[model samples]
Target: MSIFQIKQKTSGAVLWTGSAHDEKTALDAMAREAGYADYASLPDQIRAGGVQAAKLDLIS
Candidate 1:
């Protein structure tokens, strides 16, 4: 699995993080959690950034 960071496009806030087999799956899941209509429209609301290994502590 790979870790992905989903950030708000306007605020650059880290909104969600998780591990998935692929990036698309991760983004889609995060988008849904953020209340977007669909993954296709996620890019407008959030920015998908670098993929990392799952960490124990993400917020600091």
Candidate 2:
């Protein structure tokens, strides 16, 4: 597994950070738990500028 960091795209706020088999799975899981429709919708929401934050960093 690799550690990943998910942050607020605009503010750079650290949202979720953990280890996962892959980035997509991690994002999907986080989105789902946070009540999002799906992983793809996350970026759309983020682009709306505040609907939701979307930034991912691989931290090992």
Candidate 3:
């Protein structure tokens, strides 16, 4: 286990902090931040529904 911190790029404030075994765990936090998707739901949506793509492409 190791320490992982996720911070907002512009604000420079720590947004989330926890311990995980590897990078895969860290990405889970990122996915949650993007839209609050849980582990199984996040990748599933990304693989088929393009949740991330649609989020980024949102006009407003």
Candidate 4:
């Protein structure tokens, strides 16, 4: 799994930091952490442009 950093797209606030196999998985994880039943159930702000996930490069 790769490390991902999830953040609020608008304000750019850090929401979650963890590992997932891909971007889709990371978004799903974010939805879960935000208390949504699933990614599809997440609010439009989140699903559309409220949330963002980016892969991180860890320093050795």
**Model 4 per-residue lDDT tens digits across residues 5-41:** 9888878999889999998898888779879877788
lDDT of 1 by residue, 1-60 (tens): 666776655566676788767767776777688687657765632345532323334465
Off by over 4 Å in 2: 47-60
Sequence-dependent TM-score of model 3: 0.45
Q: In terms of TM-score, how similar is model 4 to the real structure?
A: 0.80
lDDT of each: 0.61, 0.63, 0.51, 0.84
Question: Among these predicted structures, which one has the highest TM-score?
Answer: 4
Error of 2 at 58 (Å): 11
Residue pairs in steric clash, candidate 2? none
How would the candidate models be sorted by TM-score, starting from the highest? 4, 2, 1, 3
| Total clashes in model 1, counting residue pairs 3 or more apart in sequence or in different chains | 0
Candidate 4: segments with Cα more than 4 A from true spot: none
Query: Model 4: how far is 13 from its true place, Å?
Result: 0.6
Checking candidate 3 for backbone clashes, the offending pairs are none
How many backbone clashes are present in model 4? 1
